[model samples]
Target: MNRLKLTLIRGLPGSGKSTLAKTLNAVHLEADMYFINKQGEYQFDPKELKKAHLWCQNQCKYYLSEGQNVVIANTFVKHWEMQAYRKLAKLFNAQFSIKVCTGNFQNSHNVDLLLINKMKKNWQP
Candidate 1:
């Protein structure tokens, strides 16, 4: 049996959450990836982000059940969001850790800005 670990990578618009997610070799489930409209504006429809979040949570559960690790690369800007992930981690009997990266820290290649601009340009809802 493999032990599942739920790693939460939280940050603002220009944080390096995606980089960290990739570094961990885990799944990268971010809401912005799902909300690319035709105009390339990365705006989620009303309540669509929540639905995407739920989908990620379900995926996480399935992976954990199969002894895989998951890294949630998203801006969990609210306490409720954190709580929800924690609850899911508990339900899966997996170890959970929260990793917060404030965009203020110095990093390589300014991934946050890149992601922001990419979303602005290519986001197709």
Candidate 2:
């Protein structure tokens, strides 16, 4: 039987979380993907942030249950933000890992510098 793996990639915006996830050969997922429109345009709605995260978590769970390696890249500024993914990994008996990306690159989502700074200020790491 193939072993399942769940990888959580955490970092600030532009920190290379997504870049690293792509190289891991897993089903790469991110909450921001929930904001993408059918046309492939990102239409982020601040009011739906919670829903977006839930969707991402649900997607991860689905893929893990199907015995696939899943990688989630998100700005998990606080440690608690990773709890749900950790629980999912436990439920699936998957080997889980948390990777923090510290590279400074251009943010694809265009998150404001001020907000990114605030997130950094409150980061648990």
Candidate 3:
């Protein structure tokens, strides 16, 4: 049997979380994906933020249950934000790991600098 691997990538916008996810050789998931439309356009709704995260988590759990490797990239500004995934890994008996990105690349979502600053200020690590 293949080992079940769960990787959580945390970083600020433009910090290369998504870029890193692509190379991890796992089923890549991200909370922001919930905001993207079928047409591949990103239309984020702040009101749906919680729901988006839940969706991401569910997807991760589904894939992990099937014995697939999964990697998720999200802002994860606070340390507690990653607890749910950690729990899921434990429940599924998957090897879990966390990677933090500190790059300053261009933020594809066009997030406001002020908001990014706010997230940086609240970063647990």
Candidate 4:
């Protein structure tokens, strides 16, 4: 049987987490997908952050249960933000790894550089 793996990609808004997730041949799950409307546009709603994260975790669990590798890209700056996923990986006996992207590419989200720098400073890896 193939080993199941779960990769968590963390970084600032413009740090290239999404880019790395796209390169990996696994289920690419991101909380931002929850904000996408039927019009095929991204509309972020701060109030729905919890719901989005739950959706992401559910998707990861579904994929892992099927013995597939999963890759999640999000600005998980703190360790607490990643604990649930780590526990899920343990539950499924999947290999878990965390990748931190530190690239300085232009942010697709258009977040300000000052905010990005602040995030980097507070980033807990």
Q: Which candidate comes out best when scored by lDDT?
A: 3
- Give residue 52's error in model 3 in angstroms: 0.1
lDDT of 4 by residue, 1-125 (tens): 87799999999998899999999989999999998899989988889999999999999999999888999999998899999999999999889999999888888867778877787899894
How much lDDT does candidate 2 score? 0.95
Which is the better candidate, 3 or 4, if ranked by TM-score? 3
Per residue, candidate 3 scores C-alpha lDDT tens digits across 1-125 of 76799999999999999999999999999999999999999999999999999999999999998889999999999989999999999999999999999999999899999999999999999
Show the lowest summed lDDT stretch of 10 residues, model 3.
1-10
RMSD of 1: 8.0
TM-scores of the candidates in the order shown: 0.69, 0.98, 0.98, 0.93
Comparing 1 and 4 by lDDT, which wins?
4
lDDT of each: 0.71, 0.95, 0.96, 0.92
- The number of clashing residue pairs in each candidate reads 5, 0, 0, 0
lDDT of 3 at 45: 95
Q: Kindly provide the TM-score of model 2 when superposed on the true structure, using C-alpha atoms.
A: 0.98
Instruction: Write down the TM-score for model 3.
Output: 0.98
Give lDDT tens digits, candidate 1, residues 14-98. Answer: 5677777889966666656666668876665656867877777787777777777888877676656778779878988888998
